[model samples]
Target: MAQFYSAKRRVTTRQIITVNVTDLDPFGQGVARHEGKALFVPGLLPGETGEVTLTEEKRQFARGAVKKRLSDSPERVPPRCPHFGVCGGCQQQHASVSLQQQSKSQALSRLMKRDVDEVIAGPEWGYRRRARLSLAFSPRDQTLQMGFRKASSNELVDVHQCPILAPRLEALLAPLRACLSELETIRNPGHVELVLADNGPLLVLRHLAPLSAADRQKLERFSHSEGVALYLAAQSDTLEQVSGEAPWYTSDQLRLSFSPRDFIQVNDAVNQQMVARALTWLSVEPGERVLDLFCGMGNFTLPLAKRAQSVVGVEGVAALVAKGDYNARLNSLKNVTFFHENLEEDVTRQPWAKAGFDKVLLDPARAGAAGVMHHIVKLLPKRVVYVSCNPTTLARDSDALLAAGYQIRRLAMLDMFPHTGHLESMVLFVRE
Candidate 1:
């Protein structure tokens, strides 16, 4: 006989418990154990005791919010941002910069089972060259809300100033907000993106509806007065420039032009250092060919081209491939070539891959280069440099290289996003 089940759920009473945090997790959460289950509490530092109320509970793990701190760690410091707790932009502002880097390094070392050779970092504040702010019209207040979202919520928090943003971009917040508030057609604005290019500042506005002539004129005047490059986006793919010239940034003395939507490093200073370090670690000789996978707009490819006999850049995006090719021509790099190919698929069968490479470099997204790891091994490059945004995937992919008799030569943590949970790392692997 089959049994029928009801949809009712169990309810448990809320309980406040004392927790002593023993460690800090990679995501900036305090780690403790309650009844043998891992308990994670945000805003609670290591060596601290707090009264925590469980916000989420599961059989294996639980999450909680600190009600009151019983003790504090010596490394704990007051957050610099006014919206630190409310704004989801930063996570480790409460912890000292040294503590933040130390916790992240320890976490990464445990994961990699190898000590980080170096930590490449830049200014802890005002390092972000690009930012995207959400826009919402408040019917109750009759005002425009422009800012980042609340932590783990869909709600928006109005931000007037952000310390992490570059100085020029931060200063434009008030003027940009005022200009947008005066526009009649901006009732339901989509979003706004600000970028500090080497040339100047650029702004991209996304709107759901078309702008009226008067509103467009006002925006144009604002752009002109502020010396900003303004681009209007009716849809995600469409961009119409109303004012200012094309924006570009220089890296390794090479000027690369990119669209507002192009993906570039958020921190410019660290990017230059990272590029130079990658070249040094690879030790590219002028007589050897190099392969750069997931190369976006030739950030590394063009630089590698300067040092290698020939360089081939493979990207999945067609527009980026075009941009990479355009940048190569713009820089008069004759030996570098860009190809649009799906990296997840078998790239070894491609014509460019058949030519082989003396060294290889790849900078994959958070998902990591799992699909292409085996391919790199099969290519049997002399040395391989892997730049990863996700440590878990990097570790998983590193196993493939290890299995193929490749050993880690160097590993360094890139403090790409400071005061935040995000960590970037680079590893050099050489054939045993």
Candidate 2:
């Protein structure tokens, strides 16, 4: 049994005080200083005096919720989403668009210390290209449920109309609910991860156990009747399709083919823009060689191959590499090569890893490439484009890059997951 209480861990009631939010942390929480201690405040605006009831406090920092507003910021606005605070989907719903963009842009500015004027903005509403809604049953009675979790508790938020999802995807929710109601063995179908490909929206339903024959038929019927794709998740970080014919989606300029189970960018509009900007920043030459790290299915490699003499994409998953090779063959690009390399572990393997490329692009996860940056810099590429979701980790890695005699050239912010405090940024580094 879990401990209900601990003497040292017990939270103490602190005086409610309003403080001006200064910045945002990696987790999308607002950062404010109170009585010389840092407090992670949610639902706050910078330059706004908001009162907070400290919930958990460490020696250096604290976490708290909004208590009262002694003074409100000029940029704070009414949240359009009905599930703003209740749902954990977006942390910056109440924050103004300009304010959020500034917060996001400042992250890049502070980290790279480079001028970032070209901000990529997209449709603020109905722009989410992908999402994962969780499943949970009501504790009081056996009531089937599907939605995201609330910000305050483990309880489901019961998201019905997500304004951030594309209209096509938003319209499919009702039909999906009806389809799920007919499934006999879907009592605990807790998560429905939806992805909008160029082909159509794909739904990956996550159940606690395997499905029966009847349940499989029901999914096929739903997929055909609703004219949408269907998928299933056997476990966390895993995905598979329930039906035989999985759908494919694409962009006008590029044809990106992948499964819902695979990792794809969440925002389609912003992703297209991100890919373009990454290539523009790369500025590959006719004779230049390029290497794309963490290149899932050639999102960057395919584009780079079009410009460079040769392009190499390395990923941890062999399936993606094979799929990437398929993608290259489909596009008839013969110069692009896909390789499976554990970047985090084999950063210093020299030619055994990645040979010297004129340019490189690394799109790493939140954990950052701290483990590999030092060893990987041995290639001494003329230019590098680093895409990061966490600014703190980006800063730590940037410090390493700077130590390797690299100078920050450009930094730009992308409002990929808008209405959320989470900031996404990309940087260009040049060897001096």
Candidate 3:
């Protein structure tokens, strides 16, 4: 039945109605009732009355857009960014911080059918360490416009400042724009990435054409003056080090370095807390063998190695596996090792899978670890910890684990991203 619901649903004509919001959906939209159907209203909160236009109609539920707010909830607060309603980066800025966290916890608890042990939160603003801002040439103003896309629209929002960015990265927005304006070589620029790494700030410029020497000189001067590392990517795989060194960030005692195109958690504080919590929940002892699936660059592998006797980190990307090995050696952790293999496959026959891990840690991408659970069951790990970014997938995978004789022992909510609908959670399952 749940699988059927996950499949595509039919839609019909759009309608407009006044609704009294009763709850919030997983996407942070307000839920209301109309004609025996639940309607989802964007920009509306529970305990509020609003008029909405139904944008999508389905059998189970309907989706709508807020046309007017009749009565606002007490938890509503004015958004900090002037571009809040326009920028696509944030959705729940109008909601108070406490309300946002509460809604997320409630949503996750209901999905997992388990009580949340704790809610891990961090600073609500200026906590974003990474951002990708869209770039376009504005012919009307004869200037380059760089910002997030307009909410639900392809148009780019011209932004001079972003409050959600870290102080250092925020300070560079105007200067970066000024530099881009002066560069005639940059035409129809793809986008710009601002990453506030632990070492310093790094900017990745994506462009179609190769950069000229003059362009490189100008960018080099900008890097030196602003104290930022800059990289240019003509294509997805073609990343050129235009200036400065590759950026690196430290997780606990482990230092992991990567190219600008690589993936890294956007929030540093929450990531550290998550790592600490995961290790604590797993309780990897000195002599226990552990397996970390989808372990990118030893975020948890190196830290776990500090306590475990031998730790194996497996990932699909060979580059990340190499980086993880380097990070382990850089941290002087000899017990840690990494393997590059597709985790979705039957990895039980793999050499690393034969280690007979006593404990396991999984941190898969948004798709979640589906078929991998079968391979994991073969290892007969006593304890399993899952760190998930999507709740629906986590719930589906939990069923698989339960069938394999593992019961959920602990669950916690992670507010990795604030003022957004994004949800990340950690769950511990112990063999019964």
The candidate 1 region of ten consecutive residues with least summed lDDT is 4-13
Which residue pairs in candidate 1 have backbone atoms (N, alpha carbon, C) closer than 3 angstroms, thus clashing? none
**Model 2 off-target regions past 4 Å?**
1-11, 18-33, 113-115, 139-142, 209-214, 232-245, 249-252, 345-355
**Model 3 alpha-carbon miss at residue 91, Å:** 0.5
Off by over 4 Å in 3: 1-16
Task: Give a tens-digit lDDT track for model 2, residues 337-404.
Answer: 88888887755464634457899899988888887788657788889999988887888898878998
Give the Cα error of residue 57 in candidate 1, in Å.
Answer: 2.5
Clashes of each: 0, 5, 0
**C-alpha RMSD in Å of predicted model 2 compared with the true structure:** 3.6
Alpha carbon lDDT of residue 426, candidate 2? 87
Q: What is the Cα-based lDDT of residue 144 in candidate 3?
A: 89
Model 1 lDDT per residue over 36-96, tens place: 9899999999999999988766677888889999998998998878999999989989988
Q: What C-alpha lDDT, on a 0 to 100 scale, does residue 202 get in candidate 1?
A: 96
Error of 1 at 421 (Å): 0.9
Which should have the higher lDDT, number 1 or number 3? 1
Off by over 4 Å in 1: 1-12
